[model samples]
Target: MRVKRYIVNALPEAVSMIRTDLGKDAVILETKEIKVGGFMGMFRKKRMEVIAAVESGASKQGGTELPQRKPSPEVNAVVEQILQTAQRSSAAAAVMEPPAQPDPPVSDKRMEREQFIINEIRDLREYMVKLSRQQSDLHALSEPMLALKERLQEQELDSEWIDKLIEALSESEKSADRVYDRVELWGEAKHMLEEWLQPYNNAEISRDARVVHFVGPTGVGKTTTIAKLAAEQTIKRGRNVGFITSDTYRIAAVDQLRTYANILNVPLEVVFSPMDLPKAYKGLSDRDLILMDTAGRNFRSELHVSEVISLLQSNEPNETVLVLSLTGKTADMAIIAERFSKYGIQKVLFTKLDETTVYGAIMNLILKYGLHPTYLASGQNVPDDIERFKAGKYVELLLGDAEHE
Candidate 1:
């Protein structure tokens, strides 16, 4: 795919520019309103910024061509009749002009305008309904497609993913039988889901990495997730694990990590400044694994994110795990991920899974950002609540089955 961006005064102008540059086959990926030519945020002109993409070989092939259809004799007769009727109506209106009278009440005029708009909207809706009915047979697989879309919406999947799935299924359905049973349709959907999720199946954290840092907004259970992984390394893998916390902003964040360190019999170092990070790492140099926890703040603020980045900069070859809460809004998750992306985030860690049933955000994040999730923390059960991420089991849960062990 080849992507390009265009900034224009209006959406239509942007579309025209995209067609001229990327051809008619170009797909609009994103669009947003932006301010330009403003001094200190005053008197700025609002403009539209559009991101468009086309297939790599689209230009060579002259883009996608529309199929030509010759109009039938009956259709041409109908069109000619409609044009003649419109011409007659226009001539009649022009010839029969009524004498001007006093203007009607302003309220009556307003009501008539409002009623006209309402009628136009109603007519448009009815026309669209008729059009859909006419094309229903062409879209014979719409039943299964609608069912899949409804299920995905109930699962709270992102619209982008749901639309992509529907598009893919629609293409596949064209070759299938005219009718489909619910079981067969569901089997096909499951197979498609598995294929879509296959790329995210590998979520294992590298054992060779010695330093792991967890960063995210407040109340995402970063410290607890680190503790869970720490326990897994120390007890299950028999690797020496140590704790380092730069989360002094929260009242009990340091103490919380310190408690976990005490329980695991590992050294805990609390650093107040970025300069203290080197000292803290030196203190835990002998350990096989060092887990670092940074203070959670409003990631929307660039200053706060920069502060966290400064602390993590000292730890070379460190894996930054961005912790996200499933209970939070997906829109917020997108913003958090975008802001924290400056830190070179390598892996994602989802927490509080037991608190919510929806798992679409997990898949959305993985697919959208290409971030591999290493662990999933379902509850607050110290080490027991966390588990390695498995794509197949995750998809099963999304399909409304209980999580498999």
Candidate 2:
């Protein structure tokens, strides 16, 4: 980068100088107002100081090379003296009466030349003052912005989201410390994340909905998540709940959910095929809330995803909850969500939160697929480990600092 500084009186003059010296590609880096040319601080004149930069190899007009230059101490002193004298002369002229006799032609020409120089100096001063104010507005955000970027990267946030966050944070005013206050920065970041996540933050499980199906790829904790929700409905909410498993492909999954059914004292129905779904639903007809657990399959197979969807079709108007693990790769989650989209999956439940510290995948999947996440399963604990998704709490979790009692 080739950086240059200009001290001038007006914004337009500084801009013109930058364009002339550094080319149109020059970027304004910083600017601030400074006082120059004062005697005993009584005649202090305000000017702008601008810091601009251009990338190396940027093309300059006229195919000419200009040597890099810095304002020397003597040059600055001379400029200050000239500005002070011009200001005094201007002030004196404004107050004093004109001479009784007209000046001679030669002297008038000299005076006009001097007046032109003074006008140029005044314009330079105005340019500097404008540049200074612009730079001051940005200066307060510099440190805080750097800190915020580092924090977002440390959290493994997406680059696009990070850029947006930094832009938003930059537009706001900084605190008196002139640095990003950790708590305040996090609060703003959380708010921004929550807004991006708001449309997908929905995890509501309708109480009146008879059947809620949990479906996803293998080993994503589908059966356990169902057990957690079932327990919540039956034990805590005082509502009658039943379990229907189309997951007979794994006897282990069947046995595990059976254990949960026994503990909760709820009925469990096992469907051997899609044809058996109607009978299972009938068996749980009296239940207020019926939670269905579907077999986790290789969702990449069109046939397998179709099979799951067909089984879900046996129970129409049912809520399909796609169970995804936080530990899974984002690419796989997206594919799984797309494959299951045919089943009309409306809600998503994320499991294995305790397995990974990075939670960007959750937000990414929800935003990408436009799906609502209804529950978060942090651990293996059947009921206690699951909670309804709260956008604020989830944002805090992603931002990394939860207050402890």
Candidate 3:
């Protein structure tokens, strides 16, 4: 048999090329896609690959004997790259191409208005195609993966992060050449989540930082979190603890910290401004650990965030932790985290875990803003309801028990 390879723009083009090169009797033995001609392995053009053959005697011109072949590692890599390029090119062409004009190009007042309408229609078409692709991708997942996706979406994870996870699972499916069962899918998700969060894991509160400041938006359980940490340091570790309240903005906040202080027999100092921080620190100088609680305001405002950051000024061995609530929306939390992150605050504490089941915000905050989570506060039962952040356990809670799914 005589074989010929033809690279063309499409199947019809390939058929035409084959008939002209190898005559009408040539049969299409194999057909696939490939890419060609690019600088530094990018900007390559997509083309169809056709392998055709004809009987040696029928051709009246012989060809080399055919041999069975399999892709080596390098060839496999090129194939994978070609598949990716083809997919991207196909999606872009489908989504971005404008409809063909019915008439020759012209410029006029009416045509200008018509062009604007056409552009708007084109944008709408792109949006609709985007929605259709999202729906199709979601539908492509099996029941287990679909359930996991729903769970993540319900937990308020960003769509970008969700797409990344689903894409990973889909790639795994391709690599294994089989669909993963529900348990396997869940397990894979859990493993991937744990792997991602592992680097930020076990970020416990420093026992050595004499001054630890807790800052957050209003009603995020900052004062309560302070009390919990104080209780842990004072009762569990048998270390001397003190409290300094810059939360003088609220009478209830002062009274609340005092109540905890009175119960724990820890000294409490109240500060009205950054000026008062010096006096407060002096009074708590003898204490092994001084936990400072800042007033939670509309930290969403950059002005308020700056006001809070100014109050956090401390010359001693100190670290600031940005406290966030699980009860809050991820977008708002992200804004708050972003505001705090700008001032070099990296450690985070989450509260109100018992109030919300959605935990994707934890991962989002950690990965998005590079905030290291130190503790998870669940309830009001001082020190008892809180625990240090562990990536493995958090992954279990975030993804649930994989096998049980």
Flag regions of model 2 displaced more than 4 Å. Answer: 1-143, 173-179, 401-405
lDDT string, candidate 3, 1-405, tens digits: 888888877654554455566654566554455799999999999886767777776643222221123323322332343344345544454455443675533346334434433443344344434555666665677887787787788778887788899899889889999988878888888888888888888888776788898999889999888888888888888999999988878768899989999999999999988988889888988999899888889988999998888888888888999999999988899999999899999999999999987899998899899999999999899879899999888877887765554
Q: Give me the candidate number with maximum lDDT.
A: 3
- Over all chains combined, what TM-score does candidate 1 have? 0.66
Q: What 10-residue stretch in candidate 2 is worst by lDDT? A: 62-71
| Candidate 3, position 296, lDDT | 83
Clashes of 3: 0
Candidate 3 residues lying further than 4 Å off, grouped into runs, are 1-115, 401-405
lDDT of prediction 1:
0.73
User: Per lDDT, what order, best first?
Assistant: 3, 2, 1
Ranking by TM-score: 3, 1, 2
lDDT of each: 0.73, 0.74, 0.78
TM-score of model 2 (CA atoms): 0.61
lDDT of 2 by residue, 1-405 (tens): 999989997655675677678766666655556899989888999997867777899886421222123333422333464455546555555446455566623346446645665666566555555555545544545654666666666656666777677777666544333445666777777788888877766558876577888888889999888888888887788999999988877759899999999998999999989788888888988888888899989998888988888877644456778889988887788788888776667688899988987777777667667788888888888789998898898877777752220
Over 4 Å off in model 1, which ranges?
Answer: 1-142, 401-405
- Best candidate according to TM-score: 3
